[model samples]
Target: MRLCVEVFNGYRPPAHLRRLARPADAAEVVAQGLVGARRIAELRRPRRPGDRRPKHTTPVAVRRVYLCEPRSGAVEVAVALVTGERTWAMALRLELHQDTWCATTLRLI
Candidate 1:
């Protein structure tokens, strides 16, 4: 989903998603960690010089997203990421808290 992409792209929650300018949910995921900033950097790294890889490597793309609502206030999301020729899978769990959705967990599948 766009929200997932936006969060991962910057490795931080968007302003609108923050509460009192504090994004505790996303901060938790980035801190105790899933898809840390280091990981994102690694994924976006360009092929090294003279590596014989294709010149036009594709940017990271969201290939697929599967959402599941197992309960009224919880959501589970499975996402597939495509970068160049490889694909990676990630999962995120969210819950509605105080009328706002908060990320409880995020990890690679």
Candidate 2:
């Protein structure tokens, strides 16, 4: 989830997080998310002279984690991502494949 926010904030490249997802989903997320994230970063309001916030800070964090094991080798994770501007709810499905967990689906709720 931190990886997703980092990608959204332009702090990390989409490819860095893409490895977590299946190939097709990775490609789709990159095509849809990367470009939009860049634009969103650009549109963010710049800091003003009177603002006291640090120049660099972690603006994203996980507010809560909801995990469910539906079956062996499969789990669903729901989390709330809190950012400076707003909170985003996300759901991810992960499956154990080749002894490694890989994201099968991701949804923004």
Highest lDDT: which candidate?
A: 2
Clashes of each: 0, 0
Over 1-109, each residue of candidate 1 has an lDDT whose tens digit, in order, gives: 4554555566354443333212656565654333433465565565686556445545557898899999999999998987667676777788888887777776654
Q: Please report the candidate that would top TM-score against the real structure.
A: 2
The models' CA-based lDDT, in order, is 0.62, 0.72
Tens digits of per-residue lDDT for model 2 on 49-79?
Answer: 6656546644656789999999999999998
What candidate 2 gets wrong by more than 4 Å, as runs, is: 32-58
The CA-based lDDT of model 1 is what? Answer: 0.62
Q: Model 1 segments beyond 4 Å from truth?
A: 1-3, 6-26, 32-36, 43-57
User: TM-score of model 2 relative to the true fold?
Assistant: 0.70
